[model samples]
Structures are given as C-alpha cells and as structure tokens.
Target: MAQQLILVTGAARCGKSEWAESLAIASDRAVTYIATATVDPADPEWQARIDRHQQRRPATWQTMATVEDLAQQIEGAEPTQCLLIDSLGTWVANLLDRSDVEWEKIAQALLAVLPTSRGTIIMVAEETGWGVVPAYPSGRLFRDRLGMLTRQIGSISSTVYLVTGGHVLNLSQLGQKLDR
Candidate 1:
C-alpha cells in the first residue's frame, strides 16, 4: 500500500483515538502508537484513561509515550510500520509555557519533518475553533495554537477526516466548490 498520512480530528470524546487506532490496525502493518499525553502515575483518572487505551489495542502493537520529540519518533519508524500520534492538543499543552517565538520554532520544526516520515502516519487532533472563545488566557492560547497547527497539518495530510458523533466526514471528498 502507498504511504498514507492521515489527520483525524474532532471534538473531545468524539472517538478520534478509536478511529485512528482502527486505521492503523487496518493498514496491516506493525502499529506503533505515539502517545503524546504526559502520564501522572498518582492520578487515578489519568491512569484509568491510559488503561482503557492500553486494553483496546492489539498485543502486537507497540506504544511510545512522550511529551516531545514527536517528529523524531515518526522519523524513526520502519517503512513497514504504521505510526499513530493520538491527540495533538495534549502535545501542544505540554509546550505551552514557551514564548511565542520558541513555540513557533518547535511547531515549524514538526511541520517540516512530518512530510518526510517513512511509514504510514495517522495523527489525531482536536477541532476546537468552533467553540466559544475561552475565558482565560491559557485556554485562548491553547485554542488558537491547536487551530493553527491543525490547519498546517491538514495542508500536508493525504487525507483529513472530521469525526463527529462517531461519524467521520472526509473534508477532501466534499470538493472545493466555492459559493462565490
């Protein structure tokens, strides 16, 4: 199969992770789940969510958890494998403390390297632009950053799926018919 770079995005609890996982499994390759969420061993709720994810995947699939160096991880995957980066929002949250310039540098670096990944890549990201403007500064910052990053990744993705209520809509398949 040809190398596929897919971006699966939707609102929270919309099954983006499950969709990405299924896609990776269907690829018929050795799947490597690149988890971007930072795990806190003491938090039972966080541990429960992690446990759910762990129990859902096949035994043959491998998982790598990291808060940074995502591009390098994708680059390191074998050509015969499939790499699934579940949720870009948490990844951005992990780097929110950096100055605007620093964050730009990091985001640009990941964007630059993503297209060069050797294996099939499926990335899960949250679509938060439709919601109300965040009341706090950090919330607003996160919303804006995730929106910008999603657009950048979508531009490079071979396919972009907008998942809503467990249904996925292929944005590209809609066709670019402008109402001008």
Candidate 2:
C-alpha cells in the first residue's frame, strides 16, 4: 500500500498546526506528533508555545521530539501509524547555519525518505515567501530554502492544503501543480 502524504501550509498563527492535527485525528490510525522545534527550557515564550501545542493534542496520540532527526523519526514509524510533523520552517531554521550545499543534501535526504516512510505523513509548513523579501542574507536563504522544500514536498503529496483565516483550501484539488 502507498503511504499517504499531506502538506498543510499557511502563514504564522494561521492555525496550520491545528489543521494538521485535525487531519491526523481523522486518519483513524495511531497518530504521533513530531515536534520539529527543539524545546528550550530557558525561553519562556517558546516553552509556552510548545505547551499550547502539547495541550491541544489528544492524549491518545503519542508525541516525539525530533532531537535525533526528523527523517530518522519518520523512517522508523510503523506502517499503520500516522505521523504529523508540525512546522518545517523551524526545522529549516534550526539548521540555518549550514552551507547551501549542506542544506541541499539535508533537504534531498528528507525528500528521499518521505515517500518511502512506513506511515502516513502530514507536514505543517509556514508560507514565508508571501511576505517581503528578507533583508538579511540568512533570512533570505531560510525563506528560499523553505519555499523550495515545500514545493518539492507538495509535488509528491497526495493532498496539499492551504490554511488561512480559519479557512482550509485543498490546493491539490483547486490549483495546478507547477513542474520544476
């Protein structure tokens, strides 16, 4: 059987994560929430944000922190399980210090693993390119890399959802996929 791939993307605070969680709940399979953002105990705001997401998840769903690596975590999942990876932007930002060449390798590895994973995958990604071009070189790199990664993921995804203003649009149904 082919594994399901779902991509949910939106601006920050646009309920992207919540929407992805809903899809996971609807899957009727054992769900695992993979938090890509590393928990920083010292940062109160970040801690609170993580707490809110944790509180929102159903207790029946297991949660995994991607301290090892997101690709590895997904690759290890059971075929019958559902994996919700909330926010790819953070994952990109976390490794922003890497050179462009290194980032490409990382992104390629992730793309390679997504389709081969045993479980259903739902990814929440922030649409950062819709705003102004970033001033800093690093910021620009982050936006560009994330945009490219999201596009690649969307290409392989069976379903792509755009969440904004509490509305969810099924891009896979409503829009045309651009060939790279």
Candidate 3:
C-alpha cells in the first residue's frame, strides 16, 4: 500500500508547520522540505519568517524553494523520498493572477498527480474560511480557491490534522466525511 497522505492545517502561528515537520522527521524516507514561499529580501518580516523556518530544518534534508514548480517537484520526488510541503496558501497566492481557466488547469494537474504519487507526502495548509468573508474580489477569489483546494486535498488525504489553540486534532479520525 502507498504511504498515508497527511495534511496539517491551521491558522497562522498555530504550529502546523512544526507538526508537519515532526511528521517528516518521523518518516523513514529521505526528507525533502518543499518551500512554496518566495524569497523577498526586500521584505524584512517575510525574510525573517523564512529564516526561522530555514533555521528549524535539519542540515541533512534537501530544500526545494519554488513558487511555481510545486506540482512538478512532487511529481519528481523519489519513491523513498518524504516531501514536507510547507504550505499551500503561498503557492496559491503566488499564482493568483492567473485566469480562472488557467488556474483550473493548474489545480487539476496538481490534483491528478497527487492521488497515486509515491513516497510520504505531508502538506501544511492554512485555514482561511473561519474568519469574515474577504472584502475584495481578489481576496474572495483566493479564499474560495484555497478553500476548495484544501477540502479536495483533505478529502483524499489519509490523515487530516487541524492544529489550533496549541492543539492538534486529527479530523480524519475524529470527524465524519462530508459526502459530495
């Protein structure tokens, strides 16, 4: 059987990334940290956040930093490679300017590769729907798209963890699946 697909999602600063990292560290496969964040040295706060994440990772692991090649990177992973993708929201935001048709194509391609993909895949996602509705069209678009993507991924994931308030809840085991 293929390894379980794990998803760790939560609000900002809720330790979701750390939880996902722990999962990767526990895996026997070679861990590869797949960063979806863009490197913007001009933004000190963003750079600091990235630096913190970088400092947290072990030197033995390989890091693939890319804003656009996430699906391709996942497709290229070795069967024994454990990929810890430290976010889905950043990746979505990076491509927010794409047309709806274009975005759908990209999303479909990613969904296609995920189902039968090899190795241990642990994804870190942000929960975006719990707050007030976005006030702008672009913001709404982002929230809807991300919400859809996470729900779809969560549907297929073998384990779904919701980390909030310093608590990690295994939604996959504790909650009922929503039938579409």
Candidate 4:
C-alpha cells in the first residue's frame, strides 16, 4: 500500500481520537499509538479521560507515552510502524509548557519526520479557530499555535478529515461541497 499521511481535525469532544484510531486500524499496518496526554493524578477529569482512552483502544495496538520529544520518538520508531499521533493540540501544549522552543521550530521538527520515517502517519489536531477568542493569553497562544500546526500538517497530508457529531467530512471537499 502507498504510504499515506492523514490529518484528523475537530474540536474537543468531537470524536477526533475515535476517528484517528479507526483510520489507524484500517491502514492494515503495525499500529503505534503515540499518546501525548499526561496523566494528572491531581485532576480527576484528566485521569478519567486517560482511562476512557485506554479502554477504547485495542489491546493489540502498541501504546507509547511520549509526552515530550515527540519528533525524536517518531523519527526513531521503526519505519514499518503505522504512527498515530493523537491530538496535536495536546502535544503542542506539552511542548510549550516544557520548553522555550518556538512554534516554527516545533513544526519543522514534526514535518521532518514523515519524509524519513518508514510508516503511515495519522495525526490528530483540534479545530479551535471557529470559536470565540479565548480570554487568557495562554489560551490565545494555544489557539494560534494549533492553527499553524494544523495548516502545516494538512498541507502535506494525503487525506484530511474533519469530525463532527461522530461523522467525518473530507476537508478537501469543502470548496466542492456546492458542486456535489
């Protein structure tokens, strides 16, 4: 099968993870789930989210918790593995909180992995630009950063899907929607 890089984008609670997982399964390749979520014991909600995700994923899929150094991890993984990076928003947030790396630097690092890595890539990113402006500086920064990352990845992705109400719409068909 031809190697494919897919980008799945949607708002929080919009089934981005589920859709990404489904695509990984359909790829018929050795799947590697790159989970960016960190388990925060202090926050019950986070713990619950982690548990739900764990329960939803198949036991046969290999899970890697690379909350940091995602680019390096992806680059180092076996070329034949089908890589699914769930939620670019969380990954960016983790990096921003951990280091002084600029957004472009991070994007470059992520973009570089697909060329040399021997695997199909399925990236998940939250679509946050449609909502009202965030009240806080960090929130605003996150929205902007995620927007940039989404566009960057989407440009290179062979397929891009936007999930809403558990249904997926091919983003490449947006402009052609009226023609159909």
Error of 3 at 150 (Å): 0.1
Per-residue CA lDDT of candidate 4, range 1-180, in tens? 457788899888989899999888888888888999888889998899889988998898999887657788778756567888987888888866534366567678878886667678889999887979999978888888888778877877778898998789998777322221
The lowest-lDDT stretch of 10 consecutive residues in candidate 4 is 171-180
Tens digits of per-residue lDDT, candidate 2, 1-180, equal 246999999989988998999899889899998888988888999999998999999999998877427888888989899999987998998889988788888888899999998899999999988878999999899999899999999999999999999899999999999987
Best candidate (score: TM-score): 3
Task: Give the TM-score (vs. native) of candidate 2.
Answer: 0.95
State the displacement of the C-alpha of residue 45, model 2, in Å, after optimal TM-score superposition: 1.2
lDDT of each: 0.88, 0.90, 0.90, 0.81
The estimated TM-scores of all candidates read: 0.94, 0.95, 0.97, 0.89
lDDT of 2 at 23: 90
Clashes of each: 0, 0, 0, 1
Clashes counted in candidate 3 amount to 0
Predicted candidate 1 versus true structure: per-residue lDDT over 43-154, tens digit per residue = 9998899889889999898889878788788878778989999879999999889899999998988998788878999999999869689999999999999998998888
List per-candidate RMSD values in Å: 2.3, 1.5, 1.2, 3.5
Which regions of candidate 1 fall more than 4 Å away from where they truly are? 175-180
- Weakest ten-residue segment in model 3 by summed lDDT: 1-10
- Residue pairs in clash, model 1: none
